[model samples]
Target: MFLGIDIGTSSVKAVVVDGTQRLIAAASTPLAVSRPHELWSEQHPDDWWAAVEGTVAELRAAAGRSWAAIGAVGLSGQMHGAVLIDGAGRPLRPAILHNDGRAFGEAEELNRRLPAIGQIAGVPAMPGFAAPKLLWLAHHEPEVLRQARHLLLPKDYVRLRMSGSLATDMSDASGALLLDCARRQWSPEIAAACGIDLSLLPPVLEGSAVAGELTAPVAAAWGLKPGTILATGAGDAAAGAIAAGAVNEGDAFISLGTAAQYFVARESYRPAPEHLVHSFCHGLPQRWFQMAALLNGAGALAWAAELLGKSDIGAMLAAAETAFTGPSPLMFLPYLTGERTPHNNAHARGVLFGLTPASGAEQVTQAVVEGVALALADCQAYVAETGALPEQIAVNGGGARSPFWMKILASALGKTLHVQEESGAGPAFGAARLARLALTGEDPAKVCTKPRIAAEIRPDPALADAYGGKLVQFRNLYRAVKPFYQ
Candidate 1:
């Protein structure tokens, strides 16, 4: 059996996959994000380790003998989080997450000061990227900067705890804004511009490569053999792509997790910064992908559910689906934590418009779902503008479990979406595949095949015109309210 661990924004998930690629057992532990200030989002490094340990124990119990037979391990995690570490390998503070918007000004300053950074780093500097957060720290917390001995992404921090290693995969490092993505190495120019030293970053490697081995102490505590190979894992998005077998050129998938992304695999590095499409390294060597990322997806629905006093999002979505007529009269902007792709507006806030006396839970719920779909529609357009849109897209993530939301999203984007079996497994399953590769030295092409298709969702012709009009209104509303965000 092979093991895969995904350190997600809201949880840590671990899965055991047998040699046949069957999921033997899976476990997860929930995590919380701390938003002490309006635009800040953080999680203590200790919380991540705790969650990983909790899930590992659960997986061991569930899998029994399979746990002892584990051959290799792979990791997948939320990308772009800045975790500063001291010389003794202790975190200086809470990790700044990818959704945090506290460094917007720093991001803008970096872009203004270095125009070539976008081309070099794959995506333009954004508040959510790691380097800008470092700049924010340099200006606000110089003491922390002075004492920082190393910088690691969220998963790398977990890797350090697992194997006493300080290394990162190319796919994850690409998002840090300190990497020369095309060259697959750290860019000294970019690092220096952000007041970072070259030595602060971890060594970059392919996600499938064996980066380290489990330390004896951790292996003993976790009931695994010492020196078990640890594969340099991927960013969650790249790992999800590996799960869907979307590694070849033109293969595509849409991830609708806490954050969403419209992704297309590419054969080579093709930066399209002008269109705001993210071009980054793939988990596999000699591969790259373009993505349009959204900071909210199911998260938007979660927030709406909380506000409407609905404890079960599935039940709420069911009610909304049952009451669905045409497009919702009300409009919602799912920018609860600002946005990433296309707009890059960190100050944007969520909005609900066209509310009336009749607008209750159903209306609000439907609008929130449709709002996320419309935001994805913008993503689709911008990605298409760069000539990378695929004909059939695979859908995955927690949100994709809702058929109603899938239908709404399909209509909004006007594309056929294939819902694969085990789609909800997402990145953890992919990480397991990477683990298999590391153990057997198998060809990734053979190991990372697409799962069986469970269903296909296409656009509803009857609701096409209504959705088209609503999409227009959605764009218009954002423009009208842009000044308010500033």
Candidate 2:
């Protein structure tokens, strides 16, 4: 059996897989994130450690006979969160998460320090990325920076606890903004510019390489053999890509999480200035990926539900099932949490317009859900602008569980939506598969499949025509609201 662990913003998930890459058993536990100050999302490294141990034990219980045979481990986690550690590897402070915006000002300073930052990163210097978060600590929390000997991201932290190694995978390192993504190595120039010592960073390893092994202490405590191989895992999204079964080019998945991104695997790294989609190295060498992010999806839907909804989720979906928008002059901009990809605006916010007293909850709810879907369509259009249209899209997440969201997204994209029938699994299992590949040099293409469609929703010409018009309105909202963001 092989083990894969995913450390996410909300939880840590662990999965045990056999040599065939078949998932044997999986387990997860919540890892609460704390925001002590505005715009700063943090989680205790101890909490993550507890989660890793707990989830692994749960996986052992679930995996049964295979537990004693496990030979490898890997991890996937939330990208860009900074985990600072002392000499003996104790966490210096709570981890700074990917969603934290407390470093926006430092991001600007870091931006001016690099000449071709945009060209190098394929995305603008944003406060959410790791380098900016590190700078935030340097400027304000110098004590933490001074005492901290090494920095690791979410998954790497878990890897360190398991392997007694300081390492990271290329997929997760790409989010640090310190990597020369095309070359798949750290940039010394960026290190100098950011004023962070290069040694403080972990070495970049490939996603599938054997990272380290479980030491005796961790082994005994977790009921595993010592020296079990640990593979440098991937980021949650990349792992999700594997889990979603998009192992080759032309296949991709749209994730509607606290944030959202559209990803397609590629054979090479080719930057697109027009679409501004992120061009980064893939988990597989000689391959690359392009992703467009929406910054908000389920997050927006959840916010709408909280404000305009009272009933349970099923009842709410039932109440808001019907749609009427383009012809009605109602529109929504689902930017409640800023945006990435095409537009790198951090000051943006979501809006709902064209409300009437008669404009009941259905209209607003449909507008929000459809607006988010259309915004995703906007990402596909960006890909279309770049000349690569995915023949199929795999939709997954909290949003994918909603049939209403799936049907609307299918209609808006004019593509078939393939759903995975797996029970409550996402990026973590994906991380395990990638780790399996990383360790055994296996081809993930052979193992994964988009689950049989529990049901397929064909696009109605009428709905498509209406959404086409609203999509135009949707794109313009960002441009029109530029001054507001500035």
Candidate 3:
């Protein structure tokens, strides 16, 4: 048995899988993000540790005797979070998350100072990247910077507690804006430019390599044997791609979780900074992928459901589906936490336009779903420009379970979407497979086969035509409101 853990924006999930790649058991613990200040998102590292422990305990309880058979562990987590640690491995403060937009000024300053930053890092210097968060701390919270001795991404910090080692995998490190991504290592020059010492960063390792053995205390606490291998895992999106069998050229998947991502695997590196598309190393060796990310995804749907006074999102979606005969006059911009793809604007905020007295819960809810679909359509346009379009895209995440949203997305993008039997189990399953590779020395291609398809969603000609018109209006609305946000 292998163990896989994912530290996500709103929860911590763990899964147990056998050698045949079948899931044995799984558990998740809920988490909350604190927005103490406007445009800021933070989570306490201690809360993450507690959630990880709690979820692992739940998994152990479910696995029973099979728990002791676990031989290796793997981790996957939200990317680009900044976790500052003191000399003794204590958190200096709450970790700033990827959706936080407080560092917009710092991102611009870095881009102004380092002209080749996008080329070096394989991504634009955006506020969500870790380097800008560090710079923001240096300027506004100097005391925290003064005492900080190390920086780790969300999963690496968890790994540190498990194995008493400070290290990160190349896939997670790529999002930090401190890595020479093409070379798969930290760039001393970029670190120096950010006024950060290279020593503050953890050592980078391959995603499938052994990071360390579990410490005896943690092993005993989790009811695992001592000296179990801990594989260097990946960021959540890359792991999801692995689980979807998107490891080859032109293979792609769209994720609709806390954040939305359109990922396409590539055989070689192809940087498209001008389009704000992310080029990063893949979880496996000698591979890469291009990603277009939006900060708001299923989270926007949740917000709309609460605002409409519905306790259940599924019911809200059903209402929206019943009301979806044609496009509504109401339109929404799903930029609740700013945006990443195509436009690198961090000051942008959500907007609801064309509201009338006739507008009600169903119209507003459908608008929210359509709005997200339009934003992803914009992202898909840019990804298509890179000539990495897939024959069919795998769709997964919390939102993927909604038939209404999947139909909307398929029509908006005009492509077929494969819904797997294990639709939302991508990241945890991928991490477990990576653990299996590390423990058994098996080929990744053989280990990460695509799951069986439960169903396929295709575009409706009429709905696609309607969305095509709505797409133009959506772009115009953003252009009209861009200056107000600035």
lDDT score for residue 42 of model 2: 89
1 or 2, which is superior by lDDT?
1
RMSD of 3: 1.1
Question: Which 10 consecutive residues of model 1 have the lowest summed lDDT?
Answer: 382-391
lDDT value, residue 350 of candidate 1: 96
- The sequence of per-residue lDDT tens digits that candidate 1 reaches over residues 1-486 is 999999999899989989888889999999999999999999998899999999999999999888999999999999999999999999999999999999999999999878899899998999999999999999999898899999999989999999999899989999888889889999988987897779999899999999899999999999999999999989999999999999999899999999998999999899999988899999999999999999998889888888999999999999999999878889999998999988999999999999999998999999999999999997888888766577689999888899999999899988899998888888999888888887788889999898888889989977756787888899999999999997
lDDT of 2 by residue, 193-284 (tens): 87889899998888877788888999998888877788787887777777787667767888776677788877766667456677666665
Candidate order by TM-score, decreasing, is 1, 3, 2
Which pairs clash inside model 2? 208-438
- For model 2, where is the 10-residue window of minimal lDDT? 321-330
Q: How many residue pairs clash in each candidate?
A: 0, 1, 0
Q: Ranking by lDDT, best first?
A: 1, 3, 2
Give the Å shift of residue 158 in candidate 1: 0.5
- lDDT winner among the candidates? 1
